[model samples]
Target: MTIVLAAAAAALFGCGTFLLLQRQLTRVLVGLALLSHGANLVIILAAGGRGAPTFVGGDEDRALLDPLPQAFVLTAIVITFGVTSFLLALAYRSWLLTGDDEVQDDVEDRLIVTRWSVSEELIDAEEAALAAHAEDVARREMDEEAHR
Candidate 1:
């Protein structure tokens, strides 16, 4: 059923995302595979009901099934396989070089985070100042009205 396939796709995507967030290269590769499978399932589901083949002498009464989704899925499968193999090779190289497949944080990423935090702090301070200024203006207007 469509509902079952949809649920399966959702589950695959959820698990893939969870694994993709892991630091280990193996887990990331597995997650990528799961994500690709989920996508393929979605494409097939979107293709709708099955009908007679588009080949010659096919049933004229029945509708012909669209072959585009199947072609897309096939192309995606090939691409995914290539990417997976390349990543596997990279993981193996990393293991060879470091004796582990765990990815380390980049220095550039840390620097970016530090800069972001500083900017965020500045924004908070600016917001606070604007809020105080608005309050002062409101208070002065109320006082002037009261005096008048």
Candidate 2:
């Protein structure tokens, strides 16, 4: 049934997203696979109920099934397989080099975050100094008026 297929696709997508968020490369690869499968299911579902094959019959009364979704799914499958293979190779290489498939934080990213935090602190300090200076100026102006 359409409902069952939709549910399965939803489950696949949910699981895939969860796995994709993991730091482990292997899990990410599996997640990518699941996501692709879910996408394929969605394409099929969008194609609607099956009818006679587009080229199979000469009868004008029978509706012909649209082949576009099927073609798209096939292309997607090939692309996904290629990407999966590449990821597998990368994961294997990572495991060989580091003895684990877990992805580590990039030094560049950490540096950027550190710099951003420092910049924020500096901005806050500058704003506070400016506010204090403004108050001092206001107080001086009031004192001058009172003396006059």
Top-TM-score structure, candidate number: 2
Clash pairs, model 1 backbone: none
Q: Summarize candidate 2's per-residue lDDT along 32-127 as a digit string, tens digits.
A: 899999999999887766455666773667766778989999999999999899999999999998899999876445555566567777656666
Candidate 2 displacement at residue 32 in angstroms: 0.7
After aligning candidate 1 to the native by TM-score, how far in Å is the CA of 18 from where it should be? 0.7
Residue 33, candidate 2: Cα error in Å is: 0.4
Q: Tell me the tens digit of each residue's lDDT in model 1 across 1-148.
A: 8888999999999999999999999999999999999999999987766545665545757666777888999999999999999999999999998899999866445545566567777656656766786898899999999999
- Worst 10 contiguous positions by lDDT, candidate 1: 107-116
How many steric clashes between backbone atoms does each model show? Answer: 0, 0
- Give, for candidate 2, the lowest lDDT window spanning 10 residues: 107-116
